[model samples]
Target: MTDLDTPAAAPPRAGALRHAAPALLGYAGVRALGLITLALWSAANGKSAHTLLTARWDSLWYTRVAAFGYGWEVRLPNGDVHSNLAFFPLLPWLERLVAALSPLSYADAGLLVGTLASPAAAWGIFAVADHVYGRRAGVCAALVWAVLPVGIVQSMAYSESLFTALAAWSLYAVLAGRWLTAGLLASLAGLTRPVGAAVVAALWVAAITSFVRERSTPPARGAFGWRRALGMLLAPLGAAGYVLWVGHRTGRGPLGYLDVQGQWGNGFDGGYAFARFVGDKFTSFPSALAGVGLTVGVALVIWLYVSCVRQGQPLPLLVYSGIVTALALCASGYFGSKPRLLLPAFPLLLPLALALARLRTSRSAAILGAVAAASAVYGAFWLNGSGPP
Candidate 1:
């Protein structure tokens, strides 16, 4: 294997959460700014920010699944069918659990889950970044993730934050050589979103590499090599199980999930559809500016992934981020949701984080402060307008 594929050595696990506290606090501040901005904007427009965050867009679909199990669907005027099954089960399951345990409604429970999970995701990002680079970079990485333009989605009743929290800890587990833990988290991630496959892939790659490196070595004093094998076995279960169940319910066999996504006009076309999407935007002057922005955004994503590879990131991170990037960019539908979809691919931000960590603390704070303000305004503008698709 190339040096780029080398496993990043795990750090001492002691005081993990205690060490992440600073990043968590910073993340909370950024999110608070976003929520405040959105709330003020909504009030000026005579709208309820609570309703916007708790009962709109994809949030409604998840709430439906939580309140009424999954046989529900909507048939659009153009003969397109949108299935609730297209929404994964994990978030709704948690929402149901929260509702049953408390007085909150399903949607409110979803909002509660997302609000709490964002910090978990932030800390997980800090943990993985801290493990590879150092405490400073890890702190920067977590804050950078919170300041993303779609950062507000992390606070909404969506599944992005929850899935990110699971995926992050799963990757951290893989980095820490806790194979069974990684696999278990990967399974839960799969139940959260289709992109959960990325976590599963990371676990498999790391485990296979370990096996190849020590094929004949005796298990160490406490090493249960079987745990590695078990992790590999468990990683795919969540996604596979959900997909197969969809097949059974729809009577379309193993390909049923594809049919469901197809009905929603979603599919992987290797970015051909997306390329044409960007090209078509250039037909008008105003649209052309958006086209240029899209070009730069896509370019930035590619550059970051390449930088990650050149930086010699651990094999698990490379595998996980690569799949997540390809899936987000190559989807044939929901072009506007690309940024939100890319939310969990935090490893791509490492190269930027490391650069930021080297700057003077005051300078870094100023830069991120400015960016966080911009993100706050944009997030408010977005949710008040059409919001992310």
Candidate 2:
């Protein structure tokens, strides 16, 4: 049989699914424990767990968009305007579709989408890790992600899970040499969140590197030369299109999106505002310790990213992780949301995942179980408290 007709030459996707099943099941268990904990805690506190997941904070904004298309705004006492246009449309659009097809409310539909997308995100994370490292490391990586402090956001009516799913699968496509699939998923990711720019940048960097490398070596037949170029061309369209549409809608030309973000006090200032915020936290002894903790956390994230580079990770993974880290750290507003924003940068967990994979299986499971229990309690506490902004 010719190359195209060779059915058994490659491992089937079913095999991959089988391999990833354990990781997915573990992730689901951790998430389920978190939900159950939240429910119990909410009952004690006289708050509904369902309300916590589907009706508060960003979830409310998303459902508003789904129920009534855009144009909603709030004028703060300080004269700042918070516009619904700041949110990307994909999650709310999905919410609307789900609500239209079923008897659920828009909020419930959003919760459903997030619930379903979380496992897909875990699967995508597993695929990327398995391709780069091995099955053991892949499972470890997914478990690590599931037990992250801010992981509860993945189960809420939020865009983080959906965005992570798209970003992970897009990166996997890049690694698998499926350029068009990468570009299309990257486009959808762009439609999901502003951080989708990271995925596009990764694809562009990889495509450019491929082109430069190919220029030195003679191209072979059936090489994905022009198709890779097409993927590069397609990568940025979704984000650019949305920005331009916002400009047209707001009549502010091409910078309209920036204006919307600006109203919310979000801008890139090279982490200056963040540093100042950290500094301001040093007024008292306890607050100073908090500042120190923040500083160490930021330093650790940067160090891990540098380790990824030194370890010679795939170019797309490095680029995507770097951009995600940079954007999460440098944004001037919503200091509390940085960790949650960094949830999609799963590549940062690879070094830890590798270390865990080297341990005895029982030891690794013990460590993961402890972390998962702590995470479940923290998630419940977090949602019951201030929660993500």
Candidate 3:
């Protein structure tokens, strides 16, 4: 059988359903409660829950992009340029496509995008977990992801879920040796978010590793070596091509997107810019406390990356995690959103999911259900009031 036709192996599944029941039930129940509570919360806050659910925040931005082609820009007091061009094109492109095919408005199209992408993300989470750990781990990973407070984003008209869905599937494809699929998805991911580079890096690492591994092995009869090598080469092309094209259009080099990010108060400054911002946060006692909290958070992120690497996680996971953590922490924009920005890292979801999967079914369900409930409420309240997380 061809590699593509070979059934991908799953972790031990004998007791997986029992182990995963609690998480699944809890996640669904809590999210349902959150949806209701959030709507009520929005109503109480003098914002129409209907409007809150249907409009505002990044949703508005995406809708605008879909309704009108790029060219809008807002010059902030800080001289930052908040431009339509800053948004990667895929989400809006999807919105446009969806809207064209149906009676849905752009906003509804975005909601549809998030709704569909969330499940895809869950599937990717399951596939990756199954590949790396076991079926139990995979089940737990999907539940954790599905129930995360950030899961609220998945229900809204945002791009994170979409980007994550693409990234996760691309990683899965690469791990399964479907290089072209990996590249195609990675390209779509790139069109979705500026941080798509992380996905590209993961694919590249996997390809290079595969290339080296195949080289060291004795030739096997009937092995499609040339086809496999070509597949590896194709994986990173999507992101690279888009970025280069963006550069071409902007009259900048292929790194034009990075320049665009800088114009919007974001860029990689080798951590120096973030340090300066953190230093300012320490000037006031209250802010200093917040700064300390952020310090602990950054430390935890570093720890997670180190732990994943030490625990024999896949190289693609390590590469993606390292890139995302670096990008979030070292980012020069709204550093407060660092946690949310890295939410799509997905690798961090594994250990906790594995732990939950090991729990007694009833107890695990109760615990995870409670957490999911809280997360949903928090997600709703956050979205209704403060915009996107």
Among these predictions, the greatest lDDT belongs to: 1
lDDT of each: 0.92, 0.90, 0.74
- lDDT per residue for candidate 1 within 258-349, as digits (tens), equals 99999999999999999999999999999999999999999999999999999999999999999999999999999999999999999999
Is 1 or 3 the stronger prediction by lDDT?
1
Return whichever of 2 and 3 wins on TM-score.
2
> On residues 102-123, what C-alpha lDDT tens digit does candidate 2 reach at each position?
9999999999999999999999
List candidate 1 stretches off by more than 4 Å.
1-14, 216-222
TM-score, every prediction: 0.96, 0.96, 0.88
The pairs that clash in candidate 2 are none
State each candidate's clash count: 0, 0, 2
lDDT of 1: 0.92
Candidate 3 C-alpha lDDT tens digits along 230-293:
6556655656776777688788987786777778778776678778877888999999997897
lDDT of 3 at 269: 69
Please give the lDDT score at residue 311 for candidate 2: 78
- State the weakest 10-residue window (summed lDDT) of model 1: 1-10
